[model samples]
Target: MTPSTEMFDPATATIAIVTFNRSNLLSRLLESIERMDPKPGHIVVVDNASVDDTTEVVESFRERLAPSQLVYRRLETNTGGSGGFSEGMRVAYELGSTWIWLMDDDVEVIPDGLAKMGRWAPRFKSIQGRRYDYDGSEFYWQYRIAERMGIPIPFAPAGFDESGYKPMNSGCFEGMFIHRDVVREIGLPDPRFFIYWDDQLYGWLASRKTQSVIVDEFVLRRTREIKQWDMGIRHLNASSNAYRYYIMRNRAIIKRYYRALGVYNPVLFGLGTFMTFCKELIRLIFVERTIRGTSNLLRGIRDGRKIANDRSWQPMPPLATTSGSAPR
Candidate 1:
């Protein structure tokens, strides 16, 4: 069947998908995008050094998508989701998209998801307060304040409390729209974060520039094979090292950046980093049984201490690259 072009909007928006070897899931996600209410002006997919026939699969769907609605780029090396999305966002920005929609290959956008998200774009843009109040108790406190202040708290599209905004904390990359201006200001995801924490970092950094509101609408369904590593505890363990390194290093960097602005609070930053290190170290020993995990934990703690003490910001090298095919 020839795809309907009636609902497609060619004016101001584009959709970008970042994929790494998930051909079957990507096919489904593309089909779903084809059925959205206000069809995307452009659809660009980045194949992140997939060894599989993912490139061929996307090509096969070209005929099924509207002309100019589909474009695909292949990467020579696996650049992780952060790099892939960074490159994709850059391409979308250059394509004259006023707003770029970002998603993962495993997420299927609902029929009206894009339209719904577009409706809330103004709310996101008009946001007037801190993306997160660094001194506001805990993260939840900020959510509470946002709600009380008449700001829409972030929430999962469904199956989560609606009274508070919780940042997308998992691999749920669908339903996020990035304004061209925000991209212009914040640049792209930090390439140093080769894997885990990139999404959170994006939201955290972007929140500084644009208002990111979690709308109370289900926009996408993430579909992929369930792996043992995906279970709550195991998933945490799998990312423990990257988490330790980035959390320690980046927190210090952020704290130092604020300090230069006279918002300095070395005591708080140091205390927080130390507490986080101790907590993660305990988790490593009790939950994750690897000596490497323990060793990394200590290394992260030592590095965090140095950052906290010196109050100097230095970017670390990207985490060692791994073949995406490794078992999750």
Candidate 2:
């Protein structure tokens, strides 16, 4: 489908950045935002109980941006990235932003990125831009849900056609540009996820209402490597056990979400879960070489299965507020 060539006003867009500690990285990202040709109308920073000088960093930028444009919400507790984004999106929606651009503090938005999104955002419900590593290598992030298999498949991007946008089923908060209406429709991201798969599930829900796409335009450069594979596809970046827990546990939640939408295949989902467990087990044993981590992954899978069955698992509170910088 052809996107409208009409230009959209950048002022209608707001940027929502979720940060935890890493004051230096947050400052760098804020500085980059300041340089955008057409800066976002408002920038909401959700501080997830950072022990560092993150609040001080936010205060430093207050002098340059309007009071409303620079908002700082310090959570009383560390709500993880999922909760942080949920609150940030709610605030952005309440502020009457037409669109919300979400990202973490670990990346810097390219100067021309927001401008490009504004130009093309009018044609799609959700837009995701490309990302590169700190060393300037293109990060392979293209992924879609194989509906038949009920699992995500990472595919490499081909040359861009004049079509301008390619449909996508999964999304990441990094450089995610979504219309406010999608937020209203799908509701804010489920904070229960607390870290992983939340954005992907939300993106899938958004795709149900309208089109979502990934544009070839470069929008962000990843400053940190959370996960990476070595030669021969060996796991090189061994993430923390906590991360491993969430990565495995969240699969059940994702499956539940798909089931609610009446789009899930039980047999396929089971196969995918078994394959994931096996793959993680091998990576943990041979690549990471951590038996404890493997056990943690197994525990996560077990608990997640229970979580998926619990009918009383309600969503977390919508908003959490605190005064001053996060506790030390």
Candidate 3:
């Protein structure tokens, strides 16, 4: 199959950002984007109906991104990150964007980040860029998903510098650069997941049609400091209760996709889920110094099982040319 593809162009790449109530962070991100020497041809800001000054923040960038299309879409409700990205990507695609550069509002694009990522586009349909944490440390991002087990492959590369790119099946939306071809193949991201695990599955789907890799170029800077549990060898970010719930519940959503691919193993996936529970439990108890969110985590697993067992939950359909709506 001659892969359905498009020529890579930084100017025609649409920068898609999903922002909630974080107007402050969005402002900073917009400022960084404005500094890009070779700017994107379009920008799509998907606001999850934030009740803050997010609208104003987006408007402020209109003049800065002159002549370049700047679209600000405010959803009627807060659909979390998943729905936001889905809507944002659909809008970008409908606008005839060649490349959709997706990210959260919390990260600031480095001046040359888009350029560095653009270099890999002619060869790769899907690309991931390196990110620096708030503490200025390179984030651990390169890895592949164990589709059968529904987990990450253990002992993946921590970071890469010497190589131009490392083969990775997984993708981080915070700095994902993908051609519209992948979107045409895989469709917009699933929005059933209100938050967690959507990116991994979406990335996995993209890898099916094209070579997905993590480019060695630094592209983003995470602005907010997160609490980390130092394990002496490596540090792990602590999680919030909301994240814990979705992370636990979203396992079923992931399994749904795996099942479709004929790689889902009930026994192996059960073991993987067990391991995740144990790891998160330890993190909650020791790293967080509190088991307060234990109930939510357990509840999530229970809900996930129900979701998996339910017969009616369907996989996301391919995106329509003009509409981004799905059954609620």
Which residue pairs in model 3 clash with each other? Answer: none
Rank list by TM-score = 3, 2, 1
Local lDDT at 185 for model 2: 66
Q: Which candidate number has the best TM-score?
A: 3
lDDT of 2 at 200: 80
| Model 2 CA lDDT for position 156 | 41
> Candidate 2 residues 183-283, lDDT tens each?
66677888888897788877777777778888878889888756555654222455678878887898888777776667778888888887767767766
Superposed on all Cα atoms, the candidates' RMSDs to the truth, in angstroms, are 10.8, 5.4, 3.4
Q: How well does each candidate superpose onto the true structure, as a TM-score?
A: 0.66, 0.88, 0.93
lDDT (0 to 1) per candidate = 0.57, 0.78, 0.84
- The candidate that wins on lDDT is 3
Tens-digit per-residue lDDT, 181-214, candidate 3: 6787788899889998899889988888788888
Which ranges in model 3 have alpha carbons more than 4 Å from their true place? 1-7, 159-163, 320-328
Model 1 per-residue lDDT tens digits across residues 172-290: 23446666666666566655555544555455445655455554555666565322222332233334566666655555444544454355465665565566666566556555654
- Model 3 scores worst on lDDT over the 10 consecutive residues at 319-328
